[model samples]
Target: MNRQIERWRTWVWVLPAVVLLVVFVYYPIVDNIRLSFFSWSAFSTSPAFVGLDNYTTAATDPVFWHSLWNNVLYAVISLIFQVGLALVLAAVLEEVVHQRLRGILRTIYFIPATISITVAGILFSFVYNPQIGLLNRALGAVGLGSLAQDWLGNPQTAIFGVIGMSQWQSIGYTAVLFVVAIQRIPRELYEAAKVDGAGHVRTFLSVTIPLLREMTTLVVILTMSGAFLVFNEIMVMTAGGPSNSSQVLNTWLYHNAFLTDDMGYASAIGTVIFVITFSISAAQILITRRRRVQW
Candidate 1:
C-alpha cells in the first residue's frame, strides 16, 4: 500500500508540469491550428469557418512565396556561417591559440551576442547607412567608393544586409558552443593522433569533427530554426521594407495579423512556419541518429 502511495505521489508531482504544458503550450498550438481554418479578424466575435481558403490564398500570394524564399536563403547562409565556419573557428581557437589569448578573443567575439537584438539591429543600421557609414567610408578609402549605396534602402541589398547582420551577431555564439563541445572531447584521441603523425588539419578532420557530431547536429538545427523564425532584427532594421525585399515569414505574419488584421491568414502563416520547422528538425534528428558516432 505504501509503495503504491509513493507511486501516486510521483504522479502528483508530475501533474503540475503536464498541466502547464497543456494549458500554455499545447492549447495555444491547437487553437492556432483551429483558427487557420476560419475567416477571422481581431474584431470578429464569430469566426466563420472557411476551410482551406486561407491556405489557398497563401498558395497564390507572391509576397508569401518571396518571404519563404528569403527564409530559405537565411537558413542556408546561417548553416554555412554559424555552423560550418564557426566550427572551424572554434577548432583553431581550441588547438592553435595561446590559452590566455583564446579567452580574451572568445570574450570579444561573444560580446555582440550578449547585446539585445534590437540594439544590434539599430547599430548595424548605422553601420550600413550609405552616407558617412563605416562600411562606405572604408570602401571609399580603399578606392571602391563606387560600391557605396543605401543598404537598407535598396531592394536588392536589403535582405542581404539583414542576413549579414544576423551572421555577425550569431556566429560568435555558435563558435562558443562549438568550443564547449571541443573541450569535452577526450585528450587521449588527440595524443594518439599526434603519435600517428597526424598534423592539425588531418587531426581535425579525423578526430575532432567526427567526435563533435552530436553538437554539430544540435547547432545546425538551432541555427536553421532560428533563421526561419527571424523577426526582431528584420523588424527593427528594415521593417520588411525597401518594398518588402527583406520580409521573412515571421515578419510577414506579424504584418498580416496586427497591421492588416487578417487573423486567419496570419494563423495560416504561423501554421506553415510550424510545419517547416518541425519537419526540418525531425529530418535532422533522424539523420543524426542514423550516423551518430560514440566516443
Candidate 2:
C-alpha cells in the first residue's frame, strides 16, 4: 500500500512536467514542421500546402548561402582559438598553478560568462567603432593608425570582429570546464609518468589528453552548437552587415520571418538549420565514440 502511494505521489510531480513538454516543446516542433511545408503569412487566413517550395526557395537564396558559409567559417575559427586555447590553458593551470591562484584565476576567467551577451555585444561594438573607438585610438597612439579602420561597421572586417568578440566572451567558460576536467585526472597517473621520465609534453599528450577526450568532445559539441546559433552579436554589431557579410542563419531567419513577415520561408530555413545541427551533433558523437578507449 505504501509503495503504491509513493509511486502515485511521484507520478503527480512528473505529470506536470510531462504536460508542459507536450504543450511547449513537442507541439511547437510539430507545428513548425507543418509550417515549413506550407505557405502562410502573418495575415493569412489559411495555409496553402506547397510541399518543398519554401525549402527550395530558401536553398536558392544567395543570402541563405552566404549566411551558412559565414557560419561555417565562424565555427571553424572559433573552434581553433576558443577550444584550442581553452584546452591548453586548462592543462597548464591544472598542472602548474597553485591552489589559491587557481581559484582566483577561475573566477577571473569566468566573469565574462556571467555577463549578458547583449551587454558584451554592445561593449564590443563601442570598442570597435571607427571615429572614436578605443581600438583605433590605441592603434593611432602607438603609430599604427594606418592599420586601424572601422572595425564593426566595415564590410571587410565586421564579421571577423564580431566573431572575435564572441570568442573572447566564450573562451572563459571553455577554460573553466577544461580546468575541471584536468583536475579530476588521477594524481597516480602523473606520478607513474614521472617514474617513466616523461617530459611535460609527452605526459600531456599521453596522459592528460587521453584522459580529457570526453571533455574535449564536450567542448567541441557546445561550441559548435553555439556558433551555429549566433544571432545576438550579429544583431548588435552589424545587423548582418554593411552588406550581408556578417549574417548568420539565425539572423537571416529573423530577417525573413519577423522583419519581412515571410513566416513560412523562415520556418523552412529553421528546418534546414535543425537538420544541419542534428547531423553535426550526430557526427560528433560517432567520431568521439570511435576514438574513445575503454580504461
lDDT of 2 at 263: 92
> Which segments of model 1 are wrong by more than 4 Å?
293-295
Off by over 4 Å in 2: 1-13, 293-295
lDDT (Cα, tens digit) per residue for candidate 2, span 1-295: 9999999999999999999999998898778888999888899999899999998998789999999988998899889977898888787777777877888888888898888889999998889888878999999999999989988767789899999888888898999998888879999999999999998888989999888888888889888888888898899878998788889999999999888988999998888777787788899998887776434
For candidate 2, the per-residue lDDT at 259 reads: 89
Find the candidate with the highest TM-score and give its number: 1
Clashing pairs in 2: none
lDDT score for candidate 2 against the true structure = 0.88
- Reference-based lDDT, residue 287, model 1: 90
